[model samples]
Target: MSSNPDNGPAVSRREFDELFEAVRTWGRWPAPGRGAWNRVTADHVRAAASLVRTGTVVPIGRPWDTRPGPDNTRPALHHMSDLGDVEPPEPSAYKDFLGADYHGKSVTHLDALSHLAYRGLLYDGRDARGSVGAGGARFGSVQELGPLVTRGVLLDLPAVLGVDWLEPGRAVHAADVTAAERALGVTLGDGDAVLLRSGRFRRRRELGPWDCGAASAGWHVDAVPLLGERGVCLLGADGDSDVRPSPVEGVHSPVHTLAITAMGVPLLDNLDLEALSAACAGAGRYAFLLVATPLNVPGGTGSPVNPVAVM
Candidate 1:
């Protein structure tokens, strides 16, 4: 195993495969397409609703970026489709168009079960090639998992550690998760959505943008088993939820492989958590009601999302 100063030792392929088998939740639910989202029952929604005390809502999606940057190679598309200058019979309409290749590092998006494959297999052992076609995914498309409402626990690492932001390439391990839980006065529960805040955007805003795909502060492989054991249905972060250069030697995105392909958990990527961090600190609570409604796009691997946290 290789070791880095910031992220500790890299996990071997054999070790990662073993961990994958340990956390694999294939066939655990009746609906194979919905995956871990099946754990969020109606009761869970009601419990999440109960956490909305002040009704302060914070949107977690970043602005639709149209400019090219080191991090955003494929910038989102936004243009005036209809302007008032158009030939108007009575009243002119002003409209705009929005499009994105959202599966990258820039857009805030939800990754469905079909988004990733491990060794040519998707969640629940669905063969990647056989399940996903040129058009879109057939087995575990975004349509299968509809609107998601659940209790969200924010593990604000910077706030807990008394820092502005954890520098890029730092690894958040399993022990750090427990420490953050204790520090934030919250506990992980079944069907809960966990959002890890490494203060990524804050760092970018203060220090300028960097290529997060090359290096970022996020979960180490050691944290997956704890989340799996806690029965977490959703996982998200300011980054794409994997520390880089990856802790797994051969794998580029080990957390994604373990969480989505193995544990069948959906991931929220590139969330703007600065506002939520302040709001949670102000409210003196880390737990809140989370409502993430992805676009109902049939056969889509994932959807660009603007999730809201209501406190």
Candidate 2:
């Protein structure tokens, strides 16, 4: 295994290939699409619904970032589409427009199975070219994983470690995941959405923003095996879910490849988990009802989302 230039954990090409094969779920699900989301059965949603006692709903999505920076390169555009000043016949009216390239550092977005490809194939060994193209995805698009609702487990690593935030380039391991679960008195189960909090936004607010795409604290490759074993349907984090200055050689986003392409699990990226963390801590619980519905764009790979956690 060759180490990344930033001195992150290194997984050799052969090791990555082996890992991919080990966790592959190709043709495992009975249905053709939806992938791991198929695990979220009616029972799972009912159980998750039971957790909403206080009826406290917290939005975990970051605000629409419109400023230009290393993180928000494709800043979201918001402009007044209709100003009532044009014609004041009777009542005043106002309207606005919003647009963004949300698949980046600054926006909270969900990644469908079509977002990643390995060896010219998507999840279920479908040909990337045939399933995905200029129009959108034909196979595992956002439409396939409709309205993800299930139990959400928050692994607040920063809170567990008693730190404001993990430093950049810090790679969270499988051990950390277990430790956080123990510390938070929660257990992950089948069809659960696991959200790892590295306190990236807290650090940025306190110490100023940096190029998260260049270096960020997130899951290393070693953590995926345990998550797969625990049957986590969705994975998310304050960062893009991959430790930047990627650990695997020749692969910039190993977590993305393994989670989406190999295991067929969707990913939630750039979530604002600060408030959710506080709410969980106050409630003395880490699990909640996670409700997220992606925009139903036909053939689209993924969509910008505003996911909510109800305690």
Candidate 3:
């Protein structure tokens, strides 16, 4: 996918038709509410027996696995506080000692609102220019995504690509997201969280901290408006969600990252794709998803997630 509208835009009538049809079949559809996050339980999925036409949804997000791995660069870990006196059993045990970096990685983590900011204020409207971006832009933490527990949908693009890596700088447009839903024969809801798989996390772990993406995997900024229109609150991907190319002349993050943050959404990055994607492909279904929030640790940019999706 390329933003070069010169190569032509990504949308197609056939893709849209399939998407529209899938939604039309989803019974008892509800309009998205203010927060737009609702957990999906097995019973609720079974209840949607009314909507099943054919096929299943594959788990399309990445799983976070840690070793004595590298950390993501986002301040907080600048000092590179030394490894603790005691050696932990598993990488996870060292999370807290990871200081702000955590296990040298923040894989499978939820993106906090504090990760980005517009000119001055954060989502909650406090002058971060006066304080830390980690504030709730309020009396406490600046992020509001801690409350996000929504119906998440996985779009397994790499499975369809028959390749491990989705080329870097390639665009995974709004239409491809929809095309995937059609391929799975599922309709997306207004509030659904979209977790994308570009197979970037399969990259070498030796890249050290802040290193992610396999050969190449990233999305385009052009998809933001449509995501906003769809009211998507979270965008989780195996790689960076927005179209920020490394070595850009002058920018911390890509424009879409800033634009989406301005819209008050969080971007979960560097997910593991092996087991999850395989399970979904084997199940031939995309129903049944769960994420526990009791896992959140405030004042951090991201956290590891072991989110499970059932068929």
Candidate 4:
């Protein structure tokens, strides 16, 4: 695709609006409410619940390692502590706040909205509604992602391909999931939380944790709606979840940004995938309803979730 040079034509504001209007009219999906929207919503919800309730739940993510940024030294650490006084408190209290950047190991975490922003927008188009954005803070964040309980299905790619790590920019299609289900004799239920294990997580035990801030792996865009139709409310993976590189190049993370961000569902990535995978393989059964809830951090973009399997 050639870049539009300065010589290219420009459209007036009116023309732009006209173009938008035409597109909207030409390709508008009829939301259910216009005709039995309630029934439609109910059907989707039931399907989602059915799929997730019967599938196995595997939490697939890594621990959020906190290290120092340039502004991450001792003095700067005061910000995360939020001490009442401007200056550091007495020596006794100093140690209490020094470790915000080094939480060590903890269970159950949900990424705060402040940790990420979509095209400068927050979850549920909160920014478009003129709401404050996720500023990497977790207190009093986001609305409930609706009660999250469903069948969780795990697609073990490493187990499938007989490799240790999937190559970067790997493409996973709906057919792959279908094949896995057929081989495993498990059909997904509605609202199933599919936990994808790409085997990249095995490195933690092999190489130790990598440097913080590297991007994680994710599924392809084409897989989103297919899962959506099956009533998937959340998709959990072992990688960072979003495949689009930061300052994403002419693309969007439609899987989450469009699916959960706009459609009011949620996605969990960066979880502990290896342990969960081992548990399922040992059980020899891939059917179980999965359940997990992030701390109710209102106005938060996400919460760290230490999900458990209700097998």
Candidate 5:
């Protein structure tokens, strides 16, 4: 419950708590760390593989951001270590190194369950302060999620509305999600990966970069329960999935807290889904085989990833 103002989506603490109780998956899974990813089995992967009709592959990863701006506070580092000009080598080799604080607007990344905490507790009721520290997370680490292979449903909101992109700060409600599903000719189901595309990158390319942290079109807390009911294993978006000026007062990222802490679902953020949207539209289908393999960093909260969709 935010005490800031009643101007936006006002959610009392009681309501948020009740929602948390209703969706919490603590003690439900056989293993402790895998969370909702456990829903996607071998059968799901095999079924997902059947989606590759044209063998069209679309990459949803944003370009490595090396330029600093209001949105990219910590630009990714990339430099050539060897340029094939040294040591009198007949067969000269070229090498490069790259690095970044990837958990921001500039990078396409996956957020593990450890990334969000509510009321001092991480997903599965683990003590946040006790489990997560300088070394990294002891529970809900990205390594535990491994590779995700499932049917992906694209909710292209802008396309559904016949708009270039949704305006920043526009809150996407459950109704909007359902409408997009109907319009896109897709239905989300168990273990499916639902990607909401707001055309953030397209808008940025056209209008130039703005402060995404201050304003972005994303999910409202009200949308989480709908997704939970659909049993979607993974959620992603062009934005970080929380509507700016968060409908919930006091909570900076209520959707993050709700989806990760309450629903035990991982998230993919800052994706560039423009190409995928076009590919799906041209194919007359919005569903595809989505594959994402995160870096296996033990005790890590999340990982920078380049997710791919095959249609």
Candidate 6:
């Protein structure tokens, strides 16, 4: 293993592979496509709903970014299809078109089980090349996962540590997760969605956009087992879940590989958790009802989303 001053001790490929095997959930769920989401039952939704007190709904997605930046290399596309200039019509109409390559830092999106692969294998040991093709994913498509409504536990690291935001490349270790849970008065539970808030946007607003792909605060590989043990159905973050300048060598995104490819847990990436953080702080609670409905694209690997949290 190597080490970085910002991200701490690095994990070698051997260590990452072992960690992947430790969290692998192959053949564990009856529905391989749904994966960990199957752990959420009707009771879980009802219980999550019960947590809504003030009925304050917070959207956790960032505004659709159309401008190119260091973080957003492939910006989303938006243009007017109709400007109400059609002739001979009784009524004029305006329309627009939208398109995105959302599997990057700019867009807030959900990652289905097909989004990542480790050693040419997807979750449940599906061969990536065979399962996913030019048409899209066959085995773990986003359509299979559908809508997700569950209890969301916000691990507000900035609040717990008395910082505005964790510095870029800072690794959120397993101990940090437990400490935040204790400080926030929330505990991880079965079928819950864990949202880690590093206050990335706050820093971006105060400073400026940086290449999050190059450096960002996020989960270290050491944290995956704790989440796996807690049976978290989903995972998300202000930044993509894996700490940039990845602690794991030979893996650009080890957390994505471990959580989505090995553990069969889907992920929400590039969320705007500032509002949700304040809402939780005001409510004196860190747990709330989270509702995320992905676009039902039959063979899509994932979809852009604006997931909501109700408290």
CA RMSD, predictions in order: 0.8, 1.5, 9.2, 9.5, 2.1, 0.8
List residue ranges in candidate 2 displaced over 4 A: 2-8
Cα lDDT tens digits for candidate 1, 43-92:
99999999999999999989988889988999999999888887869698
Put down candidate 6 lDDT per residue, 1-311, tens digits, no spaces: 77788787888889889888889999999999999999999999999999998888999999999999999999999999999898955688999999999999989999999998889999999999999999999989899999999999999999999999999999999999889988999999999999999999999999999999999999998999999999999999999999999888789999999999999999999999999989888889999999999999998999999999999
* Number of colliding residue pairs in each model: 0, 0, 19, 44, 2, 0
CA shift of 77, model 2, Å: 1.1
Taken over the whole model, the C-alpha lDDT of each candidate is 0.94, 0.92, 0.48, 0.48, 0.89, 0.94
Q: What is the lDDT of residue 215 in candidate 3?
A: 23
| Model 1 pairs in collision | none
Quote each prediction's TM-score.
0.99, 0.97, 0.63, 0.61, 0.95, 0.98
RMSD of 4: 9.5
Which wins on lDDT, candidate 2 or candidate 4? 2
- Answer with 1 or 4, whichever has the higher TM-score: 1
Report the backbone clash tally of model 4. Answer: 44
Q: Please give the lDDT score at residue 124 for candidate 6.
A: 98
Cα lDDT of model 5 by residue, 1-311, tens digit: 44322224668777877877987889988866788888989999999999999998899988899999978999999999999989874888999999989989899999999998899999889999998999999999999899888999899999999999988888888899888889988888999999999999899999899999989999887788889999989999999998887766578888889888877899999999999999999999999999999999999899999999999
Report residue 14 deviation for candidate 1 (angstroms).
0.5
* Residue 158, candidate 4: alpha-carbon lDDT: 71
What does the lDDT come to for candidate 4?
0.48
- Tens digits of per-residue lDDT for model 3 on 71-177? 34432332333455556665532223333343223455555554554455544443555545444233223133454445566677877666765655556766776
lDDT tens per residue, model 4, 175-264: 767877776667765556677777655755575544323333456544555665665545667664544232223343544544443333
- Model 3 spans > 4 angstroms off: 1-106, 124-126, 131-144, 203-215, 244-249, 255-260, 292-302
Q: What is the lDDT of candidate 1?
A: 0.94
Candidate 4 wrong stretches, greater than 4 Å: 1-64, 67-129, 133-143, 208-216, 244-249
Least lDDT summed over 10 consecutive residues: which range in candidate 1? 81-90
